[model samples]
Target chain A: MLSTKEIKQSIRSISSIKQITRAMEMVAASRLKKVESRVLASRAYTERMQQVLSHLASSIPSERSHPLFTQKESVPVIKIVLITADKGLCGAYNNNIIQTTAKFIKENTGNTIKLIHIGKKGNLYFSKGGYTIEKYYPENVEKFGYNQVKTLASQLIDGYEAGEFGQLHIFFTKFKTTMQYSPTSIRLLPIEKDAIKTKVIAKGEYIFEPSAEQIIEHLFPKYIETQIYQCILESLTSEYAARRVAMIAATENAGEMIDELTRSYNKARQETITKELLEVISGAEALIKG
Target chain B: MAKTFKIEVITPEKVVYDDTVQSITAEGTEGSFGVLADHASMIAELQTGILTISDVNNKTVRFALDGGFVEILANNVIVLTDTCTKEGEVDVEKAMAEKASAEKALLKVGSGVEKEKAKAALKRANTLLKLANK
Candidate 1:
């Protein structure tokens, strides 16, 4: 049996761990609130942009094809954009993305797939793998800014225009609710007609400012950029939520562990005291008999 | 006495302006255009310039927008811009400094992509300076 002193040391260590987990839980909760609100606020702007894009897509006939809208005939190389969190302790947030990318690569063996990592976790995970990593964005999920988004978008646009890749897809975890998140894969290029279906077609009388062709060439890239930025924001929010939930569970588990350890420690101490009392009584009895 | 349309200007960060305005004068790529209520449903690509909105009460609000798209649909105006700042938000000293730097860059760059980028920066800086001074 372990001594009372040893048990006391173990309990003390567990208590400190519990304290750390509790603090982390609180931090994640507060950060999640701020990130969630930011994601919610940007919803309106994204919706409006999608609406305009859908309208434009419906108005323009399919025969007149823009570079962003036209799909190549041959089997084309695919670029997969992986978004993950910078830090760990988020309970499978990064693992899900990495594993998903791995599974996607496994299934699409025939096609040439290049990985574009957004967060540190993804870059770290994919860098060792045999798959070709095209680019890794250095910005952390929490520090994502408009300029970064613009730069990423422009690079992708230029690459697609230069025929670097035939298709592009972004993989991220969609924040569905506080407790649930799902890995979602969205196609970013080629702007398929069905992908942008208009809700209420603009009466066929909508005018384009500098003509339809120029607007399509100009506007579609911006739409894609906005979509990508929204995905990043959503992914960040989900990461915080996942971390908060995971930390809460961890803290509670630690509390339970501490309780169990304290009970055992108290029992060990009581047993030691009882043994000493018995020994002292025997010694007193022996002296009286002599 | 004047018809009003709902106008909302949004950036990636937040919604900068949302209100009922009598008319909006924005600088499009082609040229300057004034949009009133019940204007035909259309989309105009905006340039780096002042976006003037006249409220129903005849009060004018000017915002410096650094390139975006404007969509007019059923009397609702939604402006999606990269950078947006009102007259009250702009810092004159900072804008002047930016304008000077952008002008210098424009002069230093030779012909081609860098020059085009520098020119665009200069235009955006000029727009900010105009709004700050106003």
Candidate 2:
């Protein structure tokens, strides 16, 4: 049973917290809206890119001929690119993504795993716990430009081609909406060719300006870089959505706490006043009897 | 009767322009080339430059297409590349800035191939700015 003063103090502190959370929630929501618009605008480009890639893959006879798809003669250690948000308070968004990564690492067992963190949160957690990060690209979160992502993609693909990494997997949180997010990990190495994919055929066949093999070596790297850039965009958008939902919930919880404390304060005040009134009545009655 | 074929500027991102055009002047690897309707089935590697698509009215709409493959099949031009901008949508200031950077890169390059790429970037940026301002 807290005294009225204590209850009132608790209410004041809770109200202050409520204000901060409410402001955070609004900011997150606005950012989420902007990100969603960007995603929508880019979605059109993404579809077209896929078509172009499909056309290129089908036109070229040998995908393995490209170094991006070709594996080294000897199998070596594997690496993974793990992307997580820098800030917390977004419900279980960060936790879920990290857990998925943990499960994957556990299941693989024999593979040598390394992290390439895109966000501060992922870098902090993975490094603080003694995980070796092969590389981290936090610039993707602050200002996402295609060039930066393309550079990273080239480094990884070229490294893979040079036998630095045997296999690669990238992980991030996929944004569905303000209340929904899913962690996604996908394998992007070794572009395999299905007969249907290969046989789709180019409508008009022309001689390659240089050679068919040369065009592919250049195009394949660009494709991978664009794919990774898209992943970063999706992850950042999801982070904002998660933050907005988490802050909104926090604000509501604060409101509930304020209400509960007000009730407790009122009850305590009433009890104190009743005791004082009873004492006054007894004193008057004692005086009347004398 | 003159034959006009459809010039569909389909990018990996979206179909930017799809219409019946008179001809398309594109930068090809061997040199510059023009595409008219009913051209034989062929593939051409495009350099960064201004791709002009002329409508039936003979009005030319220019687009700055980055590096990509151009597929001409049955009168359609499918362009797959990293960046694209229509003349009306281009930011002249940004294009000028990009052009300046590319020019700077070319001045400091070590190889002929690197110089060519930088020159192509500058040319593309300049093309966009010119068309947008015009």
Candidate 3:
């Protein structure tokens, strides 16, 4: 029952909203393309790395010397790198990560904990609350490459090697599909012996060129770096997918509103025209009677 | 001739190369070594240098290896490392800058082990640059 003026104004506002959403959707789509390609390209590297590591673990009879491969105690202190988007309007993307991470952290509070925060949103919320954030990286997740990730990876690996932490955790929203994203926390460090897929190529007759200790000591940090890079890729892909979906939904909703408003505006316009027409006819009829 | 095997060069970001190569020439910790079709089981302590692989066409594909290890066994060679770039992909200016910075760090820090690491980094960057640009 809205007046024509009111209906027109509503339609104008809805159209503006739709325009903004459509713009946002285009931007998200561009970012999604890059991150998704990176993930796809790196999957081959990940598989081959797994193959090499499995081969080494099975061939070598002794334990790994690097701190990352060692699992100590019944309960190990875990360091978690939580990646969340900076802005809002992504629809439960941040909420999902925060909830899952909070639960995990609270339960593991009895053990030592450290957090690596990637986005401003998570840093602000966790810092405001009582969570102790060990490090915060404010870099643009969209432009991530191997060099930056290696630096961070080296820092963590160095810390672990220095006996700073026992375990590593990574939390992020996983991009399942365009319509679905699930916040997941995964163990990132300490390539467990049982978890290895590739078996050692040479068992007893293997010869370590310079020395066994030196070769393993070198490959450990690289392994850490590769793992972290994969996580960053996943998190970025999830962000884009989430944002794109959110924008699309908004645009569709705006379209529905526009349809409703157009109908209302038409009804109001017809009523106004009919009223004016009837008034003229009545006035003419009155004039004739007079 | 022996059957061809896969040689995959994997870095942290992505796979640099994955093709069936005839041989691998890499700088091992002890010395530079080449792996043919029937190589012995060897774990190489990788230093920073140029890694060259001979394709089936006998053409050489060179990759600048930063610091990591190379494992040659069963003819399946895996070069795992922190940084890797092909000859066509290397940035010479950047590598020179890295070498200079590492040298500067070495000069400032006199700690024996760290200085050695810095020295190694400089050598790696310089050698990779030389091999890549050549």
DockQ of each: 0.52, 0.38, 0.47
Query: Which has the greatest lDDT?
Result: 1
- In what order do the candidates fall by DockQ, top score first? 1, 3, 2
Scored against the true structure, residue A35 in model 2 reaches a CA lDDT of 77
TM-score: model 3, chain A: 0.86
Candidate 3 docking category?
acceptable
Query: Candidate 3 chain A: minimum summed lDDT over ten consecutive residues — where?
Result: A195-204
Candidate 1 lDDT, tens digit per residue, A18-118? 89988998998898898888887787788788777767766777796566766753546888888899999999888997888789888988789998888
TM-score result, candidate 2: 0.81
Candidate 2 on A1-290: residue-level lDDT in tens? 89888889999999999999999999988888887777655655554554555555556555345565555535546677877887888888888888998898888767677788888777877877667788877664848577777787888877787777677888988777667779998665655344333332444454565566666666667667766776777788888998888898899999999998898899999999999999999999999999
Off by over 4 Å in 2: A71-76, A128-131, A137-140, A144-147, A192-199, A202-210, B1-15, B18-25, B32-44, B54-60, B71-77, B88-118, B125-134
Tell me the interface RMSD of model 2, in angstroms. Answer: 3.7
Contacts from the true interface found in each model, as a fraction, amount to: 0.61, 0.40, 0.65
What's the lDDT for candidate 1? 0.84
Off by over 4 Å in 3: A54-66, A74-76, A106-113, A124-130, A138-151, A162-164, A175-182, A195-205, B12-14, B38-42, B57-59, B81-134
Assess every candidate by TM-score: 0.86, 0.81, 0.81
